[model samples]
Target: MPRYNMYYPDYEKLYPGIEKRPDILRVLRASDRKMRYMEKGLKLERSVWDRKKQTIASLPSREISLEELMEDGRQQFSNGPTLDEQVQHQEELRHLHQALCSLEREYQLLLYFRYWKDMSQEDVAKMLSLTQQAVSYRERYALQRLKDFVQNGEKKKF
Candidate 1:
């Protein structure tokens, strides 16, 4: 029988009187298969580690400045919005203003106090002598009305 003493260090201690046992060959075969499987797993792990190491080593080693890192390879910052973009933005604002004007006077005042003045619902409610919940409900209704007006091409009145 071929010796398996090299692979299994405690072969003799684990399976004493192996020569007399009928299943000695079976035990040796199972041990050999397990060792081969473990060796394959180790080889695969080593190959993966080597590939990752090579990839890391191939990367640039230079230190990056904070400003350069923040820029993230952009050539330069734009000066400002283009003229066409500015005109489009202004037109949208005009439409929004027209929509606001079309709303009822109370809705207009509520929106003005809430948005243009940057007041909280509670503050606006206190100023207008209305409950906070009422102010919030009115604000939501006013915004929905504005959205409907804008989306419907400002044709219908609410």
Candidate 2:
């Protein structure tokens, strides 16, 4: 009664309300253990945001650079979802983006490298300076976190 071959992000999106099988949970837990470094990445991003805000505050009197202002506006304008793709693509994108925001960097990188870049576990281990076993553990942990977050988030919807 355990889930197999279940990607956390995909499962979370597809079945936010359903309970996960114990087998799936085991896989996710394994991935999460290897990818704990992602927590550090999230902290780093927060620090960056804090520093940027402080710098902007200090430069209040200075005129905003035109290019920076334009870029900001462009970013804001492009933030909305596009309507061209099929419904499934849009949902997948939405779920992925949500997962990206909620999960740690290690999880994101694992997913990107494995699914997007089509990298093998051995290659990932070499790149991450970890053993294959370690990498696999982190991946499972990250996926589990994603599943839990999604399931919990959905619970709040009702």
Candidate 3:
């Protein structure tokens, strides 16, 4: 099989101080992951691929400056399933969290205390000066809103 480079945005070049500021690497790596996700998208797009070519050239290949080989569907730097899933999940979770952030203060706290902090519904009610039933109602309402927003997302209802 022929070899081709899959583009992963170079975190190092983009962040010139990666050598000095190690923390920045984490953010850049996340950007690199998004870049990979974009490449996957190209694979999903039928127009970009030419079946007749039947070679690596037929694929929508992006050249990586790192010159990493696109030997398999997965990337070379993938350490293991654990970290890769976590990073991808964290990205998705971040999107959900941003949506949560836009919610009313009450619903935000209710979701955070009950779900994130792992507190009981009763505990959340007491903390928020609400009845347990009220907390339950808000939880249902908030979750329904979030679900609709995520699936359709007409606008920022929050």
Candidate 4:
């Protein structure tokens, strides 16, 4: 495949017959512009989220009330399970964490953002500085890998 070049002559050849239609080219250019804008917006939002996380971290210890501290402790403790449940949960978590760690760097992070954070494909692509198609492929591959890991693990245990 030809390397994608944004220059007029190159883009014209990239799309082939569509290049002859000014209207189609206009639409394609508009779509590209829109995608660029969305990418910018996602970047700004990520920056904002980073700042928020930092601000929360930087809050004064004294500002955290005793009740709030107690509640946080309680919540953390309660999030775990009883002994047997804990064993099962821990096993599953360990396998999943290992699988996640073993994934390609980009695929792992993108999978987390897409699956855990519930980000849309377009949003993920924008955030990752990749095209929609690239994001789709990575997401599909990551999911398939995860599924295979889980299935094979279950088979081994049984």
By lDDT, the better pick of 1 and 4 is 1
**lDDT of all predictions:** 0.76, 0.63, 0.73, 0.70
Give candidate 4's error at residue 38 in angstroms.
68
Clashing pairs in 1: none
On TM-score, the candidate that comes out on top is 1
Q: In candidate 3, which residue ranges exceed 4 Å CA deviation?
A: 1-79, 82-90
Model 4 misses residue 27 by how many Å?
Answer: 81
Cα lDDT over the full model 4 = 0.70
**Which candidate has the top score in lDDT?**
1
In TM-score terms, candidate 2 sits at: 0.39
lDDT for each residue of candidate 4 in 1-158, tens digit (9 for 90 to 100): 55554422355767778867999888777877766554444322221225645643222323434445686774434554689998999898998887777677888889888888999999999999999899998888877887887767533210
Cα lDDT tens digits, model 3, 1-158, are: 43334555555556676778777777766776777765565443224545788544343354443333554454656666687788999987876876787688989989989888999999998898999999999999999888876677535857
TM-score for each candidate, following the candidate numbering: 0.49, 0.39, 0.44, 0.43
User: Candidate 2: which stretches are off by over 4 Å?
Assistant: 1-89, 154-158
Q: RMSD for all candidates, in order, please.
A: 15.1, 31.3, 20.0, 26.6
Tens-digit per-residue lDDT, 1-113, candidate 2: 44544322445555674355767756766776545433333332221235655643222433444455686774424554466656768776787567667766777888789
Error of 4 at 127 (Å): 1.7
Return whichever of 1 and 2 wins on TM-score.
1
